[model samples]
Target: MLKLFSLSSSLSILFLASAHAESQVQLSHVPSQSQVEDFNEPRGASKGVEARPILVIASELIKYFEGWYPSAYDDPAAYCTIGYGHLIALQACASIDLGEFARPLSKGAGAALLEKDTRTARIAVQRYVKVDLSDEQFSALASFTFNVGKEKFADSTLLELVNDGDFDAAANQFGRWIKAKGKVLPGLKDRRACEAALFRGNLQSGKNSTFDRSDCAGLGVASGAGPVIDIFVGE
Candidate 1:
């Protein structure tokens, strides 16, 4: 493992070298926390059919919030995590041996693993969502699933509202997940707000995108689109 002292200096060089490491180009898959400006979507009601999922701007959003961690560490849930919030092991830190991650994880590997981890969310959104969604909306949901576990999302009222074709109510549910382990986290709050904005078809860019909100109210009054972030597969 690279020493912590040299990590920052060595990181960029390492990433440049490892840029060639990810040969098999791939793209891919959360929960929680909330911001963004509200906007009105031009589309009407959602079509009651499954659509293959694709991502737009979710990766950059995720990376911006999740930051980068090139080493294994325990998350708030005690899971052995690595890369960009990838759960290498779901068990508690004391229960699992992290000897395998003794070496410093590379940014390239982390990016690949991020794509790999996001696959689960993409599959979940594809399988469970019963309504047709725009790319921005789907990306928002995908981002949500990536943060929260699949089971939680599957059983969530948000999913229920989406299936019921109640988008406004569904949008409101994004704020319900801002708490981690019962405490309201600022990071989570900002993420949900941004996601809600995207879900409402408002693509927010630059420094002013994040807002400190707790719910999805008033997110239905605006217009715009977001940028594409990563490789995604859809039908």
Candidate 2:
């Protein structure tokens, strides 16, 4: 009887151990659809969905512009410096569904740009654009304003009307840049069209998108095949 009882006890222990292992294995199965969705969302939503990493997107966008296009990297007042930075700002308008700021220039202003300062241009962008953009938008706009100045863009009918909520008309107005100094300038026309396209939210030019997780170095910002920045304090 003792031997039989001992064997029964041993068998019970093994059964319990096997059951526990099976339970643990079941618990470790693939995450549910909702769980996966929640994990993938940008930081800042409710439970499950992580908040969006807009700022990181903005940061990477700005960095991309700086690295890829430097000619447009001037202070407010330069001209013909069109670069990736300008492209990012122009694209931000569309991402947020806002209007583009289109302004002509005077010859006297030439390359005497905005001195690489961000304060004035940022204020102008916020005031005139009427969209609450991320820091990347602001930074990109500041760069644009640095190159073109707020007055030039703000005073234009295209931007003014767009701010008034006429998107179709505003889009049509982009084509007006087909001429310069009483003559058609293919380059300026192309530039204007490109800017308008960006304002339409096409990231083909790589504006407003986050960098590769592997590319973001020392930013202390979370990244992976997952969201770019896990948190944003806002600016």
lDDT of each: 0.59, 0.37
How does candidate 1 fare on TM-score? 0.61
What would the per-residue lDDT of candidate 2 be over residues 120-194, giving only the tens digit for each residue?
Answer: 444556667774444443443443343334555566555565677765455444445333223443333343343
Model 1: worst 10 consecutive residues (lDDT sum): 31-40
Clashes of each: 24, 15
For model 1 the local lDDT of residue 152 reads: 66
Q: Name the runs in model 2 displaced over 4 angstroms.
A: 1-120, 131-148, 206-235
- Model 2 residue 87 lDDT score: 28
TM-score of each: 0.61, 0.34
- Which digits, one per residue and each the tens of the lDDT, describe model 1 over residues 142-216? 888777655567877778888899887777677666555434455666677778877877655545444223333
